[model samples]
Target chain A: MKLIGENLNIMSKKYGAALKAKEAKPLQELAIEQAKAGMDYVDLNIGPASKTGVDLMTWLVPVIEEVVDIPLALDTSNVKAIEAGLKACKKHRPLINSIMVRPERMEALLPLAAQYDAEFVGLLWGPEGMPRDENERGALCAELVFKATGEFGIKPERIFVDPIQTPVNVQQIQIMSVLEFMKMFADIAPGCRSTIGLSNVSNGPPDHLRPILNQVMLIILKRHGMYSAIVDTYDTMLHEIARDKHPGLEALVHKVEDGEAVDMTHLSDEERSFVKTAKVIMGQALYSDSWLEI
Target chain B: MTFQPSKQVYSGKIREVTLGSGDKAVTIGGRGVYAFHSFEGAMPNAPRIAMEVWDKDPSEDWAAAAKAPFGDVLADPAAWASKCVKEYGAEIIVVQTKSADPNGDNRAAADVAATVKKVVDSVDVPVIVWGVANHEKDTEVMKLVAESCAGKKVALSPVEEGDYKQIGAASLGYNQLVVASSPIDINLAKQLNILLGNLGVKAENLLIDPTTGGLGYGLEYTYSVMERAGQAALTQEDEKLQQPMIANVANETWKCKESNLSTEDAPELGDAAQRGILMEAVTAVDLMLAGADVVVMRHPEAIKLVRNYIAKMM
Candidate 1:
């Protein structure tokens, strides 16, 4: 029942410059604040805007590390940026944002993950694209796991598979497919972890809709063995689930995740009492158990 | 000297397309009667339904009626799907890779593969692998997806104008089916079919998807195109366009603000949930009648209504 908290850090090239100019101090401080606020990892993303070939991680990671000791999830589309961050990372074993199923990318990144002895996120689709059905998709997942464990020599426990999230506007069935797949991964590959980016599905809609959808999707993903996700570190909905304080809190969390105004008035005293009771039980059963270890 | 009257025969939307050698073959649904009536005249085995799943989360804008069944399970895919199969009766599950959207998680290929595998393991029903409409990402992810699902016979698709080669080759290599999508234009639909054919993906292995629009958002356009495409398959007998059809009903219906919003916001509106269900149901049935082999939808109530309508019609 102990809630395992993965650091939820949002690191960006935008924040890095802000830190240098002193104007960005708040952004870095914000990330540090998230870590202080109970995030297990602060995600560092040096987006495309950053100068290429320069190792920002070598400099920035230390600064963040100086302020907080939490683990980091090195997130980047650029291989160089990831390497820079990894090189400067203070934590002994940080989580790699991802290594996709593409042969070239996997070949390049898997070794890095192995060399660092880091936990890695493995996407299901490779160079071809997402398949249309579960059987083929499952086969694809098996192949990735095989490569991660057999070829990369990484342990299953260290590998987290991200069943890529598709947009609801286009491929509607994919939403259910992802949740089913998450469950399948958990059942089939118990040693490995499952996770996803929490904000991808509601990409095109009104801004308010995103969080509610995310919360609902997260709960589905969590039930299906998704142990972690790359989400806004400060999201209350996420905190509710991670804390396991209220099982029904998912309804409210989903509303918030979707950007809907949460009306606590809907809950009766009985429901409110249930949430309080659940929170106490969850804290005692899940969180309190791990306090001593931490 | 008495004369007997013939009964009005109705057909379902499920169709089965058989390809390859005995037992080592693939069977995909194309059950709508209008598609290829000359062959079997349409009894059962109409097109299947693909349920929706998202990469991030489904928004609250979803009609309360649609969201009600999902309840607590709405948050998790595995739990939701299990309910769909066990409770709601989903025949085939389609996992849309929406997270692959470039603006979103822009998740890598391995993530797509993992998710596909997870759903495959969750149920006995077949699963569909879908891309998030990013041609570049689809090309990148599907190859790994095809390779990962090798010999499993999953359907990978919506292989549109610019990126058919990558998806086609991957599907062909994996021995899975490909969904060839085109705008509502019948000629364009046929052209895409021909393009898929040229790629060496057989007609039987192809599922034709003429893009769908929801109620009030040009459903008539979709209906006309689908009907024309179906008529072409039946009367004109165009082999290229004769393949099964897949229509996404839930995506379009849910997008209609009328279906998801509260009636209180619009007093003229009837029951919003019922309206949403009706929109999806009507769209699904209309597509089926128009010759859709597969009707992918969201709301369970809508699915039930469609199923019952198909039952009554057949």
Candidate 2:
């Protein structure tokens, strides 16, 4: 599985002139921290806050790359920023945050990807906007896969299709769509990858809602063949939740523990055996109270 | 004296059925071993390819290399089908009713039906009728068209969760095959198939479209999903999901500007037509390798390339 770290978390001047005078840690420092924290790739983004706009991405990407050897997931809404970021990136190969199903958007972004030999996240929604229904959305997703592979020469392994996660509060069936889109992606493009913004589904909900939704979604997505995601590296609660849901962690730990038969079928087994193992080895100071204390 | 591979040969959606009388028919879903492991057992029938025809004029953005052959015939579906069969050697013709696009000219159901009838009548091989993406309009348009070609054994697609009832009923009434489209997830794919099954739609009458991605468009993710689904269908033996798979190649292939736009835009990229054809060919090959039973594609060159590959594999 490709490891991904969230981009640009600290309030920085590069984000905007208004934020420039703020005392937040530099973006470069934050990236180095994430790298030291064991992230495989640092997600870099210059959202609406950035003063230099896309120029900041081009400027900061190299600085972050200089400090860390990890690959980058270039996260930006601005096309020019993506281009600049792609140019600035020293990593051999980077993953583009996304190119939605809109033809114009795909036309603009996919060529840049092809030029740089970069991987991309292709969203399912087209110029008409996201379809309200699951089947339609799934069909659109299927269509995007076809376009990405059949029209563009991008390799299947390099592409990651995002099914466009919707907030649970807005639409309940969207949960089903997420699951369905993951399955459809597996069946149609067996070699392609799938991912989503872990934080998107919980947007506008309570702070605690994010972790639970992300973990459940992650487990189902992973089971269905998704192997990568764009998420906050600082969200330890969410990370723990994801760790608990991972299908192979227990098995791997069991192998390490001299093949102890861990009854992974029940939630209690996860609490007793898995949580206990983490606590014993990592110590109370290192481990969070969320998984073990619960 | 002999070398043996570990995995067995299993067919998941897209096996060729041979009748006692020497007639050959294609069916999907049979599992005795893993894919392409003939040493383990009989691995009969490679996947088949379907040529695509649409109602709209071949857009200017289409690669000149691929579009030159179809030139004037691109305007008419019947001419396109005839050209594909006579010139391209297509075994099956897939006609996408793009003229039914609600956002576009919004042609009436009768207009869509007329085109479908013309294409169906023009070809002796089996046909697949794809509805435009609009749900309400597709339901309204496809019903009359499916009825028009009743008992002729056409494949009608894109029956999703919200709209399967109408499309499924239409397919049943017409004695046609229905495609069940699910997103990239496995459980939902299974669930949708199960839902279709509950509606009295036999597994054989259904084709599972798991959705696909092109080369740069998360194709690996799509490949993994399809591979897992195929594995699940065979190893887990989920009855509902053990249907043939269908992928519409042309619709996706033509959309990418790299394939469709002129090479003048990106000189570093060579020959738009060949590039476009190659993209489709690569996508078809990937899907086939990943266990897709049927591929619906555009461009005669791509069709030819896939056919030759299939021949070589056989």
Candidate 3:
């Protein structure tokens, strides 16, 4: 299982600015913290570095590589940037952010992965945007496996399939679709592993509720063969909950994921619920004595 | 497309495992594709057969068909091994530690090492020294055999998870190949290989035995599992399972009740000798198709049949 640290990326301007100026202190801090938290790879996404993507990557690769001993996941769709970062990477099995079933993405990234001897994340979507259901997602994933392995000659185990997880607020049933794809990832490509963009489920949800939603979805997806994740490794709660704290959690998560009532008698309604920690954090739950116990 | 074969593109080669030192060495595996699937990928080394010979003579208990080929040399393992490499066309020799079983002669490790030395000197083709499935006794005997055959690189067989540390340490110290054996489970098989690697055994010094299942008795299960391991080796680049595989098919087939029965009782089965030989041959062929790199078998006729089958395919 690969626990990827995905905090330092171009999604936020704070992170973007840090990479733009080749800032080392803040990035080094994140790398050391993620490395201490048992992350297999610290993902480096340079979305704001788009214009100078290749240049920024060439600069940031050695900066992060100097401080962190763990491998770095080069998070970008830019081919030149990925190659630049890969060249700068030394003694690390740098993991590529993604490729897809689309002709351009597959033809470009798959061969790059083979040439650089790197593991890659194959996104389960083409240029036409994300799949609406689990079946299409699976089909696309299978196509990714078929081409990456059958054509590009990359090892199946080296490829990690990303079943695109969008915000549940936008696509309510997406939670189930991604989970279902994770369940079938093994059969799609026997030795291949599944990964999810952790924060995607919380994209439209409230800022305070994001981590709770992300953590819950992570636990649920992990049950269905989700091994690797593009996750914020600094979230102590996410790391804590990853171990499967409660026994009936799986059944409860499944029931809720399937949009059915949990039949487990052992757990309380709040305990079986998805937004427990979020409600507590937002002061919606009364400060009862047994509140922390649950 | 000519109803084309299912082709898989793989970059990882099953580690070409070499046995014996200097001039006598023979390599197995080193193919980048599934066994005999040359319509797509290259199978560099044609799978070899290692004939089995026991240290002590079995005058009567031996299956009539099995004993017929080497009737005179049965008393002396050296002569038997010599005959296998010399005449019967054995590419390699397998010396079983069956007599070392506590139920049988219970020969001590030192005594067994002397016999091993005799066979080692008799045959130039590399030897495989296998133990009774017993963990403690096998550990002792295999370690002594490792010491006796130091620098010779004879493959030491039946290195189970329980006794891996001892056997692995010996292989590491003596610089020999270790046969990482597991009970028909791919995961268990991979784990043993990983443990052996951690014990300093090089990838080239490893061979996998995925515990061969006999014909008509869960042979399909072995086929699927072996196929899975081979796929992992080639496509997944799983170094643990990515080494030559040796199937003790003859031993498994011989132990089955179907192969041992005389035609007098089961007369419908036809000639007992021919039936037994076919059973061994068919099992070896099935194992080869399932990505076996070296097949350890008994009987001259089965060896010839398997060899001929391999020749036509190659």
Best-fitting candidate, scored by DockQ: 2
Q: How accurate is candidate 3 locally (lDDT)?
A: 0.81
- Candidate 3: stretches off by over 4 Å: A1-294, B1-6
Reference-based TM-score of each model: 0.47, 0.53, 0.56
- Which residue runs does candidate 1 get wrong by more than 4 Å? A1-294, B1-44
Residues B1-314, candidate 2: write the lDDT tens digits.
68864663344333332111112234444534444544665546557788888876766546677678889798888988988888887777888887788897788988888888999888777777888767888898779877888767777777787788888888778667888887765546766777777677776678878877776676676677677666655654444556667777667766877686677877788877788988899998888877777888887778888889878875
Per-chain TM-score of chain B, candidate 2?
0.90
**lDDT for position B162 in model 1:** 82
Cα error of candidate 3 at position A218, Å: 6.5
TM-score of 3: 0.56
Error at B308, model 1, angstroms: 0.7
Interface RMSD of each: 28.2, 16.6, 21.9
Ranking by DockQ: 2, 3, 1
Docking verdict class for candidate 2? incorrect
Error of 2 at B200 (Å): 1.0
Model 1: per-residue lDDT, tens digit, B66-146? Answer: 778787776666666667778877777777777677887787777866766666566666666677777898888778777
Off by over 4 Å in 2: A1-294, B1-4, B8-31
